[model samples]
Target: MVHRIHRIHRIQTLPVTPDKAWDFFSDPCNLARITPPWMDFRIVSGCADHTYPGQIIEYRVRPFPLVRLGWLTEITQARSPVFFVDEQRRGPYAFWHHQHHFAAVENGAAVRMTDLVHWALPWYALPVRALVRRRLRIIFDYRQHALERLLGRAEQGEDACRA
Candidate 1:
């Protein structure tokens, strides 16, 4: 049997339109700004500054201390102001799929952002699932805080979280 791991991040709502939220998250260049610097994550090739359907991205990443791995991912889907999906083609992991979703709040003054990631390492690497899960959370936590600083609240700074 193949083991799979799934993780989801429901980030705090942002006081912005779906289109605004989508624009920031969809831009490939914004990744580095939001990512934690200690990971030493850097884009190696494949339009790291642009994003489009069928776009391929290559990156040099350090998942562990002094451990660097090359990762390649494809933008399988890209729809403006709504969602996008990226899947791993060549990377350290056996499998990886990530979905980014955005929805406007009922009041239309805020947007909700969500990230769902599914991944699996090699068969022999099953023992690292716990560690991987923990690390993922930490990574996402960093992203959440970054977004909050960027578009977390409106200029009015009202509490605009969704109901």
Candidate 2:
């Protein structure tokens, strides 16, 4: 099999306490909520509970036309309010690993979410890579927007209390 690897790195800042931010992100269900409905991500496993090492989460995603796939992954490392790492056990990708890092910053905290994925198609390598990259960008953008909305709601609540 051929291994084609790609990495996606993102940094987002939120105006909330580390505990609060961690609480929001630590819930796996939040992922489904943030992800665009068009992607059609359904948790095949590990959604009934929060994440922990040795937990395997499987998803079935219909990302595009004629591209329905299964992504099976296991959480290898997890540190509450800090970071977590997930590696693909079986999926569309030949191999996939993702690490999510969070650190407290000026206002609240900075999140650095990185995905190191290795995947290859039986044929049409170039097209597959291009398509994956484009779809990942859209997914991350949707995540950012969802985070902003969540934070905005928190801020509005604070303002109301202060008023």
Give per-model CA RMSD: 3.8, 6.9
Candidate 1 residue 89 Cα shift, in angstroms, is 0.7
User: Candidate 2, clashing residue pairs?
Assistant: none
Model 2 segments beyond 4 Å from truth?
Answer: 107-126, 153-163
For each candidate in turn, the TM-score is 0.86, 0.80
lDDT of 2 by residue, 108-141 (tens): 5433333333334444456667777777778877
Candidate 2 matches the true fold with a TM-score of 0.80
Candidate 1 residue-wise lDDT, 72-106, digit = tens = 99999988888899999998778888988887885
Q: Native-vs-model 2 lDDT?
A: 0.68
Query: Model 1 misses residue 112 by how many Å?
Result: 0.6
